[model samples]
Structure formats: C-alpha cells, structure tokens
Target: MGFSTDAIHAGQEPDPATGAVSVPIYQTSTYAQTELGRDKGFDYARSINPTRLALERSLAALEGGKSAFAFSSGMAAITTVMMLLKAGDHVISSANTYGGTYRLFVHIFQQFGISFSFVDTSRTEQIRHALRPETRLVYVETPTNPMMEITDLEAVVVICRERNLISVCDNTFMSPFLQRPLALGFDIVVHSTTKFINGHSDSVGGAIITARPEHGERIGFAQNSAGAILGPMDSFLVLRGIKTLGVRMQRHDANGRALAALLADHPRVGQVYYPGLPDHPGHEIAVRQMDGFGAMIALDLGSLEAARAFLNGLRIFTLAESLGGVESLACHPASMTHAAVPQEDRQRMGLTDGLARLSVGIEDLEDLEEDVERGLAAMKS
Candidate 1:
C-alpha cells in the first residue's frame, strides 16, 4: 500500500467485536479473565491496552520498525531508552539536542552515573572521535532543534554498526511521513507524538520504534516497568491524528519551503536556519535522506530585544514553545526551548539570543507571509 493508504489503514482495521469503523478506545483498567489463568492478551491497562496497542502498531508500520511503544510524554520515552544502558554506559549526542533532553541527561541521568558527550554530530568525525570503550549509544537529532543542523545518518549508522553501539534518532522534527531512520539502518527511532504525529497539538505523547527485536524487547520492558504508558484516550487521539499525517505533512512541507524562502530573502532576517534552503550547508544531505524538508525553520534577528519585538508583533503565529501543530507557532529558542542548556553551551551550538524558531503550520501561505512581514516590520521599529 502507498504511504497515504498505510497511514489511514495500517493497524486501523474495523473492530472485530463491534465492526466499528474506527478503533475504539479500550478504556478498562483490567480485562476480565475467562478463568484463573485463561484470558485475553491484555491483563492491565498500564502494561497492555488495545487503544495504545493500535497506536504502537500504526507507528511501527509507519516507521518501518519491528514494534513501537507509546509513552506518557516524549521525556518518558527518552528516559526509557536511557534505561537500556547501565550506570557506567556513555552516550554521544548532538550538541543542539532539545533543551529538555539535555536537561534530562545532565541533571537526572548523570545522577545515575551515566555520562554523555555532546558533539556536533553533523560532523560524523566528531562522533567517531568522542567514542569511548564505555560508549553504548549514539543519540542524534538531525536538522537539530532550532539550529537545523543535519547529521549524515548513513555515516552515523556505519560508525555505530562498526562499534556495536545502539543508534537512536529522534524523528520528531521530520515525522515518519518525511523520514524513516530505520530504513537508514538506525536501531531505534523516537518521536514526541505531541508534535507531528499528533499534528493537532491537542495531545501529548511519545513513541519509540525499534528496528530490531532486541531493542523492542528492552524498550517494552522499560515501558512496562516504568508504567509511563500513554492513556487510552491519548492513544486514540494520536492514532486519529496519524490517519491524516500524509496529507498534513505534504501541506507542512509546502508551507515550510515558502516560509523558508520568505525568511531567507527578507532584509530584516539574518542567517535563516532551514535545510530546505538551497544555500543551507545541509541541504544536499537532507535531499539525499529525507522525502521532504519539514516545516520547522529558524532565523536570527540579531539580538534578544529584536527577537522579542518580532515575536510580540506576530498576529497569526502564536508565541509558544512546542511545534508541529496545525496552527503556526513561533518560539525563542534561547529563552523558550533551549534555555535549560547553559548560555555558553547554547552559544557554542550557534543558538543565539536573537534566534527565533518557527513551526510553520498548514495555514495559507499568503497569511503566514503577511504575518512574518508584520514581525519584520516590528523588528525594524
């Protein structure tokens, strides 16, 4: 089946019991057993849920993985992945990873004796140089948050395979509709389903899709042990949202290109960070790996005051932190998304105080352009 067909139909068959067109939310906490030991596959909601299982199946199919596990939030999903390693394990990560991930590693995981090395994974050589005997995993975010740096996944995969290291890619920005890291040989792919997979911004959830059965088993174990499973209602929501992912992502890609062009050409804008842009350093690599450039774009206004003026001036685009919603959102990374990282680290990653990250939505291009113009006009003032 085609991508759109799979999006709408994979793991979304009519209800076997009721023949309902939509997958019903299995809302019960526990299923009644036929006898003491004989029962359905589901025993408990936290460990197994029909609605959540449907979502996992759909996402696993979408990502071309062996299986997927849904979590209460993106952080929970990431935390579970971290559980795959022991205390002495080390991780190599992108320097411009999301602030929340950075915070999780530095504050929480470090306390558990796990160590990390943040490097510019866009430079595959850096990843190689940072490897240690204790290195067990490579956590990467291509077209990395706000900075929009693209990592060469094929190269990273080769390095990890040679070193016998687990390779995990955060597919939140591109979504499975745009990029499938598993196809690129990544051992695992993670998503903040709160973003593109649930494109409406109405729900918050996360997912981990494993290419290998071993990863699926371990992540599933951690998910059950931690009991951070996504609720049935949220699972249903994400499943519904994914049905329209193919169509939504197409519109997102189109609008993203238009917005990136507008920002790059604007006199007020400086250093537009979009892999879709022809002049962008990662454009070629992105073209080689991704089906389409996504809607996330970042630009520099030169100072914190200017960024504030631009954000406050926008009318259509909401000033918010999260992205990948149907309605556009603009965020200041230095203060909003990456603020958890120290100022020095953010600076080293090229995330300046003046940077503004835009989550281009499915809104009409002309309206979004006008709103951006309004922000630029305010910046000038």
Candidate 2:
C-alpha cells in the first residue's frame, strides 16, 4: 500500500468482534485471563492497549520501521530514547532542536552525568568533529524547530554507521509523508504526533519508531517501566487525525510555498527560511531526502520591535505556541519556544529576537497572505 493507504488502513482493520471499521479504543486498565498464569497478548494497560497498539503499528508502517512506541508526550518519547543510555554516555544533537529537548538534555540528563554537544548537524563535519569515545548517539532535527535548519540525514547516517553510534531523527517538522529517516538508515525516528500527525490541536502525543528489533524491545521495556504511554482515547484521536494526513499535508505545502514567497518579497521581511525556497541553504540535500518542503517556515523582521508589531497585528494567524495544525500560528522563538536556552546560546544558533516561526495551515491563501500583510503593515516605520 502507498503512504496514504497505510496512514488510514495499515494497523487499522475492521473490528474482528464488532466489525466496526475504526480501531476500537480498548479503554480497560486490565485484561481478563482464562487462568491465573494464562494470558492474552495484553495484561495491563501500561504495558499495552489495543488502540495505542493500532496507532503504534500505523506509525511504524509509515516510517518503515520494525516497531513503534507511543508516549504521553514528545518529551516522554525523547526521555525513553535517552534512557537507552546510562550516566556518562554522551550525545551529539542539533544545536537548534526544540526548546523542550534542549531542556531535557542540559537541565535533566546532564545532572545524571550524561553530557551533550550541540552542533550544526547540517554541516556533517561539525557532527563528526564533536564525536567522543563516550558518544553513544547522534540526534538530529531536520528543518529544526523555529529556525528551520536542515540536517543531511543520509550523510549523518553514514557517519553514525562508521562510528558505531545510534542515530535518531526527530521527524516532527516533516512527518513520514515528507521524510523517512529510518529508510535513510537512521536507527530511530521520533515524532511529536501533537503536531502534523494529529493535524488538530486537540491531542498531545509522541511516537518512537525503530528499524532494529533490539532497539524496539529495549525502548518497549522502558516505555512500560516508565509508564508514560499514551492513553487509548488520545491514541484514537491521533489515529483519526492521521487518516487525513495526505490531504492536509498537500494543502500545508501549497500554503507554505505561497506564504514564504509572499514574505520573501515583502519589504519588511529580512530573511525567509523555508526548504521550498531555492536559496535556502539545505535546499539540495532536502530535495534529496524529503518528499516535500513541509509547511514550517521561519522569517526575520530585522528588529525585535518589528516582529512583535507584526505578531500583534495578525488576525487569522493566532499568536501561540505549537505548529502543524489546520489553523495558522505565529510565534517568536526567542521568547516562546527557544527561551529556555541561555541568551548567548540562542544567539549563537542564530535565534534572533526578531525571528518568527510560522506554522502555515490549510487556509485560503489570500486570507492567510492578508493576515501576514497585516503584520508587515504594523511594522512599517
């Protein structure tokens, strides 16, 4: 089956008992058994749930992985991945990853004796240079959150293979429809299903898909032990949201291109960062790895005041956090998303105060353009 087919029907089969089409949410906390020791495939909800399993199987199929694990949130999935490492294990990650990821690495994991090196993974040599004997993993976020940075996944995978290190790519920005990092040889692929996979802002969830059985079994154990699994209800919602992913992403792509072009030409727009743009630094590599240039776009307004003025003027674009939804959202990364990183570190990664990340949605192009124009107009001297 193709990607669209798999999204809707892969792990979702007609209910064997009820014959209903949608995968039924098995909401019970425990399952019945014929004998004291005899059991069915599931024993407790923390270890497994039918609905969450359906969603996990769907995500694994989409990412071309052997197995997938569902988590309470994106951070939970990330924490499970880090649990694969012990204290003193080192990790190399993209410098401009999601703020929550950075927070977990420095504030949380670092206290446990694990260390991290923040590098520009777009430049493979930076990743290569940052490696240490204790480095157990290479983490990447292509079209990275807010900044829209891209990492050459194929090349990074090659480096990981040669170094005998694990490679994990956060595919939240460009969901499996656009890029399959596992197919490109990444050991693991993680996603915040709260974004594109859910499409609606109604549910918060996360997933981890792995190509190898060893990795899958270990993470599965951690998922059960940590008890951060996604509930059956949210799992059902995410699965429902994914049924329309193919169509939603198509509209998102179109709107992203249209808006990026509009802002690129605007007098107040300083620099637009979008993979679809030919001049974007990682355009060629992105062209090779991703099926499409997703809807995430970031732009510069030349000054912090101008960016805020534009954000305040927007009517259709809600000034809020989170992205990859059906409605447009605009936010200042310096204050909202990437604020946890120290000011000096944020600046080092080019996260300027004036930088605004736009999650273009499936809306009328003219209306969306006008909303952006409202922002541009407000920034006028």
Candidate 3:
C-alpha cells in the first residue's frame, strides 16, 4: 500500500470483540492471568499495551523497520537507546543536534563513563577523522535542529560500515514522510512523536525504529526495564494523528517553502536557512536525499535584539519550544532549544543568538506570509 492509505489504515482494524472502528485504548495496568506467570497477551502495561502496540506496528511499517518502541517522551526514547551501550562505549554525534541530546552526551553519559565527541557530520572527511577505536555509534540529525544542516546519509553509512559503527538518525524534522534514513542505510531512526507524527500537539511521545532485530531487542529491554513507555491514551491519540500525516505534511511543506521564499527577500532577514532555498548550503544534498524540503525554516536577524523584537511581535505564530505541530511555532534556539550547549560550541555550528527557528504549520499560506511579514517589520523597527 502507498503512504497515504497506510497512514490511515495500516495496523488499524475494526475491533474484533466490540466491532469498533478505532483502536480502543487498553488502559489497565495489569492483565488477567489464567495461571501464575501466564497472562492473556499482555502481562503488564509496561511490557505492552494494545493501543501502543497498534502505534508501534503502524510506525514500524511506515518507517520500514523490523520493530518499533514507543516512549513517554523523545528524551526517554533517546535515553533508552543510549542505555544499549556500555559504560565505556564511545559515541560520535553531529555537533548541530537537539540541545537535550547534546546535554545527554556531554553531561549525563559522561558521568556513566561513556564518552562522546561532536563533529560536523555533513563533511564526510570530518566524520572519518573523528571516529576513534572505541566509537560504537555514530549519531546524526540531518537537516539538524535550528541550523538546518544536512548530513549525507549514504556517505555516513559507508563510513559506519567500514568502522562497524552503529548509525542512528533522528528523523524528527522531516519525519518519515520526507526522508527515510533507514532506507539510506541508517541502523536506527528516532522520532519525537510530539512533533509531526502526532501532528495535533496533544501528546508528548517518542519512538525508535530499527532495521535490525538485535538492536530492537536491546532497546526493547531498556524501554521495558526503564519504564518510560507511552500510555495507552497518548498512543491512541498519536495513532489517530498519524492517519492524516500525508495530508498535513503536504500543507506543511507548501507553507514552509513559501515562508522561506518570503523571508529570503525580506530586508530584515540577514539569511534564510531552509533546504527548499536553492542558494542554501545544504540544498543540493537535501534534494538528493529527501522527498520534500520539510516544514522547518530558520532565519538570521543580524542581532540578538532584532531576533527578540521579531519573536515578541509575532501574533499568529506562538513563541514555543516544540516544533512540527499543526499550529505554527517560533523558537529562539540559542535560548530555548540549544541553550544547554556552551556558547562557543553553538556559535561554531551557526546557532547564533539572532537565529529564529520556525516550524511552519498547515495554516493558509497568505496568513502565514502576512504573519512573518509583521515579525520581519518588527525586527527592522
């Protein structure tokens, strides 16, 4: 089946017992057992839930992964994957990554005896140079958060294969609709379902999909043991939201590209960072890898003061930390998302104080352009 039809009907069937169309939320903590240590299909909620299983099955199929695991939040999913590594294992990650992920690598993982090195993954040579003898994994977020940096997945996969390193890609920005990293040779794909996958801004959840059964088993053990599984209600909501992902993504792509073009011509905008823009540094690579340019755009206002003014002036686009929701959001990555990374490191990656990351919504293009114009004008004022 094609993507749109799969989005709506995959892993979803009429309820066998009640004949209900929607997947019912199995909210109980524990399931009835016929004998000690023997339960019906589910032994406990932590081990599994019907609603979450439906979401997992659907997402796994969508991403072309062997298995899928859902978590309470994106960070939970990330932490679980990190747990698969031993204390002494080493990880090499893209320098321009989500702030929380950066902190996890720099601070939390270090305390556990694991070490990490950050490098620009877009440069294949830099990635090759950064790999150490102990490097167990190479983590990357293509069209990276805030900066819109594009890493060549095929190149990275070749390097990883040569070094026998696990390759993980965070697919939140483009979602599976725009890019499927697994198809490009990534071992694992992670998503913050609170974003595009959920679409409605109604749930905070995360998912990890892997092409290898061994990797899935390792992550699954950590997910169940750590107990960060998504609840049944949230799972059901996400599943419903994903049904319209194809339609919503089309609108998002249209609005994002239009906004990028508008901002590129605006006097107040110093620079626009979007894969859709032909002049963008990553445009060629993005065109080669992705089906669409995706719904995220970033603009530089030339100064922190101008950025603040623009964000405060926006009326329709809410100033928020999260992205990829149906409603538009504007975020200051220097302060909101990448604030945890040291100032020097952020500057090197082009996450300047004046950078404003916009998650273009499915709103009408005219309204969004007008709204952005207001912000641009305010920046000039």
TM-score of each: 0.99, 0.99, 0.98
Between candidates 1 and 3, name the one with more favorable TM-score: 1
Q: Write the residue-wise lDDT of candidate 1 on 41-111 in tens digits.
A: 87889999989998999999999999999999999999999999999999999989999999999999999
The number of the candidate with the highest lDDT is 1
Ranking of all candidate structures by their lDDT, best first: 1, 2, 3
lDDT at position 197, candidate 3: 95
Q: What are the lDDT scores of the predictions, listed in order?
A: 0.94, 0.93, 0.91
lDDT, candidate 3, 140-221, per-residue tens? 9998998899999999999999989999999999988999999999999999999999998999999999999999999988
User: CA shift at 239, candidate 1, in angstroms?
Assistant: 0.6
Candidate 2 residue pairs in clash (backbone atoms < 3 Å): none
Q: Any runs in candidate 3 off by more than 4 Å, and if so which? A: none
Arranged by TM-score with the best first, the candidates are 1, 2, 3
TM-score of 1: 0.99
TM-score of model 3 (CA atoms): 0.98
